[model samples]
Target: DGVEDDAMIQHAQVFGKPRTPDGRVLERALSARSSKSGKAYREVVKLIIRPPRAEYDVKKLGPTPFTYVRRFRGGKQTVMRTEFAVVNQRQDVELKCSQWKPVGAHLHELPCVLYLHGNASCRLEALQVLKVVLELGCTLCCVDMAGSGLSEGEFVSLGHFEKFDAEAVLHELRSGGRSNGKVALWGRSMGAATALMCTAKLDPLVSCVIADSAFASLPMLVHDLLDEKVGSVLVDACVEINQCVGCS
Candidate 1:
């Protein structure tokens, strides 16, 4: 019985058990492993303990409505095809967007949000997320991050070249009179990082930003993805590519 108990305790060390005694055994085993692989274990511990960065101001944008379409072309209304642009603007060309209007008292003078999506995602994906923002009495303008939805463009650029397209859309929003100098930029994943980098160049008219799941740096993202796919040796290659062409 005593020998069996010792064996059970050793088994509990690496793989945790549900019960308290088994958990204690697992803790001991972990401590032993940590001691055996001190440096490697410490690296993992640092990764876990790393503090969250102060990136964006998180606010509920509100609930939203949708108008789906077969394609992005505009000019004539057709079945299931809908367009979203500033309701009261002239100078700016109407943008092809998947929009969600919040259901509530309108904040006529408040700012609107321009949402950008991640790789392989489209404006349509913003429906649910925009709805939440609308519920907060904020209007949402989810743009197709060029090449992903109805918007035009050939490459993704991982946000490098893509940033230009986003800037153009914002410029149109502001100049077209659809925007009254009060606009916010919201992005997720790659789009979120793009929004952050864009603030460096955009007009102060962009009052606030909301970036979710953004990486600290562009090259870092590429390195991590490549490491996961082809191992760390490719990290140097990705970094070199990033330096040459500026991609993430």
Candidate 2:
């Protein structure tokens, strides 16, 4: 049993190293030590990989009416709504997307603002700002990130994998001529981090990025959670285990 635990630690060492924004590897906090017991480590890893899924009644936000009226810039304006799907080529997941545009406005005429929802939230979360965006006269688009909403996926990777999902949506918008070539990203919490990560790869194409309440780092977030629940004594051990299991 000792040998098996050691083997798992060695295996995790191969995947736990974090990378800097420039792609440089950062020193691991617990590289030279292993947790005293693997039970807690395993539990933490399980929680990270399979977080609770956020399920809701799609019909409540549904049928995506053909058009909606909103008071924009002191006057009433009619906005057209369209629903569609985009395929995340990286994961082969279909992301459900919704777009709102000013009536009679062509896609090429207005800037597009893509909204990313927080953890445990779906595209419907974007409804909170629908009126504001409409008043700004920008085209608004929102998609259910894989695993979070009506999108296809079994788990959420915070930002690691969701970044690719965002990329796929951007690609669809650009290639499908869905926007005016100027796109902005707005996200909250986990979605905020996803926007930051996704924007790093497509800096030139993005006109602006607004990240709201993003965590400092994944490991730190996990450590804080562990510290709050189990105690600081197990924080390092749990985080170390998290990285080794490729859930970093």
Candidate 3:
């Protein structure tokens, strides 16, 4: 019931306004259970506080270092896509980005946040967030991970394989002369774990990271899933095999 209580608390906060002697304080509003199961069951529920929403005045940014319309193999129509250039490093690559630049935007090399979506999610999932990022005078790049969006690949290595893709995008940005500005990495679920691993390996150019609902480790997450079918020992063995194949 933690989830249930949180839902109820949020609902109460929405409909019931605070009543007080002075007027109506927005603070003191709802009453809820204090403990999971205890004598002190009756208690005023603390309303969840949220950061105020920020609005931005954004201008559209068109065509980066590598932007073009290209067609995939087989008789097909051409579609606009971001392209990347190979950089001199261990599989590091750069991606042409899509951003909305606000008017009067200073040529200041504004910091950027590269967004990595969850399993089966694509760069399109973060478009709304990108708009907000632009409003704050920050740049954003949404990566279509290998096999997930437009990036080339046949299968997803979950976090294990996707981490490489994350590194490639970062390397490309840094190599393409975005070094002077700050870089923040944001990811959700599997992408979040990938971002964390990428941050640990990359240089100081990565300034910060924002991870949403990330698992602890790639192996651990797989182990948890497999444990229900086999056992911990078998799960551990599978992890060892995966490591031997240079998966993690």
In terms of TM-score, the best-performing candidate is 2
Candidate 1: where are CA atoms >4 Å away? 1-95, 102-110
lDDT per residue for candidate 1 within 118-145, as digits (tens), equals 7766675565564355544456667765
Which should have the higher lDDT, number 1 or number 3?
3
lDDT of each structure?
A: 0.50, 0.72, 0.51
Candidate 3 C-alpha lDDT tens digits along 195-241: 88778865456788899989876567756665665555444443433
Candidate 2 TM-score to native: 0.77
Which candidate leads the pack in lDDT?
Answer: 2
> For model 2, how does the per-residue alpha-carbon lDDT over 1-248 read when each residue is reduced to its tens digit?
45544554444444445544432232233432354534665445445544566677766554544455555446456667788899888778899888888778898778889999988789888888887887787889998998778888765677777888889888877778888888889999888988998888645578899899988677788776676665665566545544544445
Instruction: Report residue 200 deviation for candidate 3 (angstroms).
Output: 0.6
Q: Could you estimate the TM-score for every candidate?
A: 0.57, 0.77, 0.54
How many collisions between residues are there in candidate 3?
2
| Candidates sorted on TM-score, descending | 2, 1, 3
Ranking by lDDT: 2, 3, 1
